[model samples]
Target: MQSSSELFPVALMSAELRGDLTEDVYRLKPANSPDPSVELVLTRLGRFGQEGGRGVPVILLHGSFSNRRFWYSPRGLGLAPYLARAGFDPWIAEMRGHGLSPRNQQYRRNRVADYARYDLPAIAAFVREQSGQVPHWIGHSLGGTTLAAALGGHYLGEEDVASAALFGSQVSRNYWPLKVPPVEWGGRMLLKRFEVLSGSWLKRGPEDEPIGLALESLRWHGLFGRFGDAERDWWAGLAEVRMPVMAVAAAGDLQDPAWACRKLLEQVPEEHRHFLLLAKDEGFSDDFGHIEMLVSKAAEREVWPLVAHWLEHQRLPLTTAALEAVAL
Candidate 1:
């Protein structure tokens, strides 16, 4: 078993490579009408053994209110190098309103649909242009939802993804709803009204803002609790996906329950779909919750090994008999 400290060196190396990496960050100007541009930043993981590997490229998408940097932490949660060592070139995307990518200068409204329509498509195109491959996407939370939307033909004309994996995401309304405090509801309603009228609202700094707003959005939109129309439609789009998918969730996750995650897997059209649930006692002692599945100390030991194994199985094109045997 590799110690957490052993992982730090690799992470440091990765950071150094990223610091020197030179990739163009572009502002995607929409076609036809002059709509506000969407920010696009692209960077490559340097000189991995799998640079010329035969498997489809892989891209990592972060959840709401997060940027690509979350995946590069010195902790073992960073999946890029691990994927690289397993023979896949990894790419990370920062959606608008997180990290270096923010809303357009002319338009600051934060709509989830914008992620599907612009950010996802732009990143896909950029990956294809740079790598000459239609990549497989792996997303967490809102990132997963956005990818499902894109794959379902809600945004792009024809799906270019060969396969996808969603971690800690679900579409059931009965599961968890946003938990906004009543005291904040009035303030939020007023803010929304202001945004509608003024075309933009105040942008809170990361430290200055309270988690209540984010929590409320999830509650109101049924992201954390019950399923809603948007979530159902999102899951319906999953049925349209022709490629294989892997869905995972944590057992103790209050945000997305384990049963809900398995339910999501049951709806997948692909027979090759696989589901995984990590019990809270598996290896983590910090009471690893929802987001920690991707960013915790136990991730390398518990979470990613499953992902690595699945990817390896996928590369060989296992037969049903072989898959069943492997499962057994």
Candidate 2:
């Protein structure tokens, strides 16, 4: 990996129109990090059919073992197009080694801390520079967790964010034996030996995850572990965040249960926050699981509209103090 001072500048790698939507992909190199070779790709989705109605900039982040396809499939259909048609400029980000972003020199050594501290800020800066506005960020699973970490650690500031929505993301879920020191330490040792975990082999998703991420998670959930790194405690920093935020959880998501998701939302001691649970018990047609909560046909018809509504309302003027005090 090159030194931070030797890192290259961000540039537009390519642009093409898929059907009626224009797709522009940008690459960003970290300005200051241990590994300057790490590059991130942001794919912008816009509706070419509508010329004059460019809406607010909204960035969508995919979870682990996934890429931009999580938001827009190869068929040119999904939430990215859905948002583009709705008037918003949607950018789908592919974290290092995922999708179009090529693997960095230290790819196998990547961690969530590296992502929150380096990649996200680079992505935010590039988006703000290009769009001339703080982008509203929406992330799922590990993606959402990284957003939360950036906010809490002040890696991404209020000036860099318009608002944020986290879908099916949480850090409070406990893995029973992993909480034991020996078990956690042993697990970390075992995971660190591998360069990457294949999603296809694991039957988890469409991409492979660096083993460093798995090691990072093990350290956080281990005995005496907390939702934080050596520098900051993200779990506690949530209360200091004042921006508008939304957390969505699925009832049938055993991977990250609704209770755990709500607990994460509760940590943010603020008024401009909303919690949504996709459960049949909550008047939905079915109990939605982790992936199904966002990618299903039901989500297209039911949930995506709510997401669009939130994005639209987030741009509105601040409400009264009294009204803002009421939790949604």
Candidate 3:
């Protein structure tokens, strides 16, 4: 592994104040990755009062066809800002070809494997260097799935993560037909015809997805396929993850249902792991959908506070001895 400065040359793009929150944006390029064009954009948000304290660093990963905006709006409203207002240093990352990130030279060939092996570790290294501490991670949907891949494959170790919280993410919603050889081949052939999936047209979100991502997912769900990459079995590898984990699901999420999310959570052998289902039965007024579970106004009142509490639990307590040590 290379030093953070060597592996990722960062460009501090801009900094501005959003109401009382300060937002700083940085672009990080993996100088060592085979794909030279790949670059990731990370946005850091902190409150004016919390600057010197440097609150517990938290990174938020957005789902597919979305960007940093998913965690925050132009007006500084959303979970990222919410966390910052509560004295958490929140960082939002945009994956390749999404939001502020530029498309890699092999953008069309980008896959979750690439993200797990190359992009994530670079992000972790950069964050650790900047913060002087391991950061907790939170992801939604495909973002969460990629986080799972990184953890399951051991791309990230316990030292890299304080904890992980995944929202509406899973790999267990199996499609049986894709398991068949002929069906798999046909699907791949059809998908290969397109270079990217139009998120705006598909009504999924604002950003388009590279066709390579679709193909990679098909291969995983295919009959002979498994969750891991070339080196390890990701599903089996989950049991080895030692960090405290949380998996959240929305009852009305037809895309990735609660049961499927639970199945993914169940695979993790960590005793500290937990699952939360956002359903009417769970006291939420409605069975929250995939997006609603995180973005709705309801989330502002209920979900965001839960997330803040969870992050607080994982943070290292600041004892007087520790403060004195810092002074020395």
Residue pairs with colliding backbones in model 3 are 179-223
* Clash number for candidate 1: 13
Worst 10 residues of 1 by lDDT: 3-12
Candidate 1 — what's its lDDT? Answer: 0.56
Clash statistics: count for each candidate: 13, 0, 1
- Per-residue accuracy of model 3 over 146-192 as CA lDDT, tens digit each: 99999999999988899999999998898999989999999999999
RMSDs, each prediction? 9.5, 4.8, 6.3
For model 2, residues 169-241, the per-residue Cα lDDT tens digits are 9998889899787888788778877899999999999899998888888888887888878999988888888
Better model by lDDT: candidate 1 vs candidate 3: 3
Better of 1 and 3 by TM-score: 3
Candidate 1 vs candidate 2: which has greater lDDT?
2
lDDT of 3 at 264: 85
TM-score of each: 0.69, 0.92, 0.93
lDDT for predicted candidate 2 compared with the true structure: 0.84
Expressed as tens digits, the lDDT of each residue in 275-327 for candidate 1 is: 75666443333445677787766776556655666665543213444433433
Locate the minimum summed-lDDT window of 10 residues in model 2.
319-328
What is the C-alpha local distance difference test score of each model? 0.56, 0.84, 0.86
